[model samples]
Target: MTVTDSATTALSQGWCALSLLHGRIETHIERALQGGHDLSVREYSLLDVLSRQHSGVGGHLRMQQVAESVVLSQSATTRLVSRLEDRGLLNRYICDTDRRGIYTDVSEAGLALLAAARPTNDAALREALDEAARDPKLAPLVAAVENTHHDGRA
Candidate 1:
């Protein structure tokens, strides 16, 4: 094969591998959600973010921050937060310092849902990690995907 052809083939293979890995992770998360958790992966992600924020000094996360962290658009994040709020799982408060800013806090009900969903989330993640760890070549790929944009600078 020519050098150009070889490079193209390698790139195509990499794309295929990444797609397959993404599909597997999506399936695992879907299973976790459907196994009586009643929470979509996005919802679980939002809840997880809120939980960690509450553990920090502020006890809340701005909507934009949550959107960025979860890879959702601003409108999508607002809708997701609305759904959670409707379920009494979260509370939205306008920022006192920034009038245009909105912050979300996990409600008691939200915390309860997260607590109930923790086992399933933990098990799914552990299973995915363990399987990936079995293949040394896959571990770095997984880590890279997980930390794609997680540098200290933002």
Candidate 2:
């Protein structure tokens, strides 16, 4: 293969490995969360994110921000929020100052569920990463993931 072609092939392979790693991890976590807490990965993620909000300035997240954090479209995030709300795991309120803005927070039940599910998620993630690390094609990606900081500074 030509130099350019070789480079493209390598990049594509790297992308595929990353995608596979993410899929496996998510699936593992999904099973664990669902079986243990009746929560999907997305639902657990949404609850976890909303649980971190505070009343201070810049503490509340907007719908778009929540969607971005959960890696879902805004509409999907809203629907997820609604589901949780129906389950008594979340509460949505219209912003007092800005009638156009809406805010969501985890209810007491959601916090309790999140607390219980956190360990399940973490263990599933660790198991998935360990399994992925055993695969030659995914080892490097797994290492990269494990070494990365939350701020993206490795």
Query: TM-score: which candidate is best?
Result: 2
Off by over 4 Å in 1: 54-60, 129-154
| Model 1 residue 83 CA deviation in Å | 0.8
Clashing pairs in 1: none
Candidate 2: stretches off by over 4 Å: 149-154
lDDT of each: 0.81, 0.94
Tell me the tens digit of each residue's lDDT in model 1 across 1-154. 9999999998897787677666677678778876767898899999888878753566667777889988899899999989999989998888777788778888998999999998888788768766775666567667775576466442
| Residue range 1-154, candidate 2, lDDT tens digits | 8999999999999889888899999999999999999999999999999999999999999999999999999999999999999999999999988999989889889999999999999999999999999999999888887778545885
Query: What TM-score does structure 1 among the candidates reach?
Result: 0.76
lDDT of 2 at 123: 96
TM-score, every prediction: 0.76, 0.95
Q: After superposition, how far is residue 68 of candidate 1 from its true place, in Å?
A: 1.4
Candidate 1 has its poorest 10 consecutive residues by lDDT at 145-154
